[model samples]
Target: MESTKTAMEAFEKLEKVGEGTYGKVYRARERATGRIIALKKTKLHEDDEGVPPTTLREISILRMLSRDPHVVNNQIEMPLTKSNRLLDVKQGVNKDGKTVLYLVFEYMETDLKKFIRSFRQTGENIQPNVVKCLMYQLCKGVAFCHAHGVLHRDLKPHNLLMDKKTLILKIADLGLARAFTLPIKKYTHEILTLWYRAPEVLLGATHYSTAVDMWSVGCIFAELVTKTALFAGDSELQQLLHIFRLLGTPNEEIWPGVSKLKDWHEYPQWKPKPISTCVPNLDEDGLNLLSQMLEYEPSKRISAKKAMEHPYFDDLDKTHL
Candidate 1:
């Protein structure tokens, strides 16, 4: 690791671009090289642990997965200023003497959320070719992670970074990703955004697999086509109802063992409607792939590797991607 005191002098924060539960993100520039980068500053307390285990897990995972172009690259350095911690995320003290961790990475211009909002604001649909390309890239990146035995339990538009110019998308924010090899462990159902969350997770199934991410991919696919969230829910129950109303209430017949999940309950039933009614603009092949991703039974849901081969993406030129 390089001397972070020198790392501190090498770059300057340009502006705060975003903020999340863990830290603030800045659009920064390396003074010496004139290279722009994104700086994620993770705050720590002197009274607490040296570094959060979640952050360390993310570092380990990113090191393994960043070789894929679709996964965001993480660059490492030593602690800045007066510090005793050994970390790749350069450490320093804030103005108030509070410890902070800075993670440096190549900057992306925008994220999927803002990109979709741009099209929505302009009353224009994201081009079909562009949608396919984005989704294909998403599947490819996701396949890479799953193939490596890691589960990115959370996948949403905000976590997907993109370059406004090339529309190249990269998966980020791996703090929520769990890399434990399975026989799936009982994780908390509390993970993932409600709308993108899998039906099994919403039903209180703790032992989830990679299918949860596929559900989010399906939601993102629809949002890209319609320029609106497929299912936007404010609460846990509301989220389930939104999904149930559209996909129709799930039962043992379609999603066996669903009724036995921890959060299972009696609810009003609705027959499954043709999936096309919602995304009327999506073509047959797109609908087919979306349906497979949104499958109620986790086991029946399509894998990312399988999804990348779907006919919906057959027209894409893979050489560049």
Candidate 2:
């Protein structure tokens, strides 16, 4: 396939974005188009270590998702500028000996965390209309991803980005995303951010599907409305209890085969609580939507498309493209 942008022409130098468990990011510009973008410079360690797997996984997945506008589009370096490519930015040895790689991306103004922090600094809480706009755009992006068979296993406010002009939310960080089709692959039980994880994930359910993402969507939507992390827990068990306390504990009648999960036998038992007890201030429509999203049974969780058609969004009359 033809490449989109070359390293030498992408940028010179700008400012740093942030550092994570893996690498650092910088804001840069495209020399050719004069457009701004983020240059994520990752360290390539000698041993197959922290930076390699996640870095390579993110690059591979971003390349796969390059064509989708709703997803962060990667600017691939071209072969014509192969020699001129900016390899000196970093150095390392691959499995086949010496090699180097660099990743370029469109510059995002700020992430959801930064955006919300900025809003809080001004003492102006996000309006419902603004929240609806952001959520709708985020769902639209995620819906497009799910439609094309990609599952963003990790969905959290931090992974969401907002552009300055329209404030349209874009789902960033594809490091944890993978394509899922029937006869799913056997993977680890550990996935998703602790607060945004689905109930099935906490129950040690391995055969998960798009429903996992739907649960995250619910958590994100609720958090946006409340302006705080919905189920902020430091542990797996705590996270489960937090969710149960809000949405009520799951029973065999509500979620069938609860006892058959890989780690079901050792879980603590608790009585379910009504939603009103946890979120007394939430309107009936909001509670109803959250209940559908946080459903213990994956089969019963609402799809991204159906969630878009929910009545909670009826008052949001503006189009956010």
Which stretches of model 2 miss by more than 4 angstroms?
Answer: 1-10, 43-57, 69-98, 121-123, 265-271, 274-282, 318-320
* TM-scores of all candidate predictions against the true structure: 0.91, 0.80
Per-residue lDDT of candidate 1, residues 50-166 (tens digit): 766777787777667654333122332211110111123577776787777788876777889999999888999999999998898888878878888888888889888887766
Lowest lDDT block of 10, candidate 2: 78-87
Off by over 4 Å in 1: 1-4, 68-88
List lDDT for all candidates, in order: 0.80, 0.68
- Kindly report the root-mean-square deviation of model 2 from the true structure over all alpha carbons: 6.5
Residue 234 of model 1 has an lDDT of 94
The global Cα lDDT (0 to 1) of model 1 is 0.80
Residue 317, model 1: lDDT of 85
Report per-prediction Cα RMSD to one decimal.
5.5, 6.5
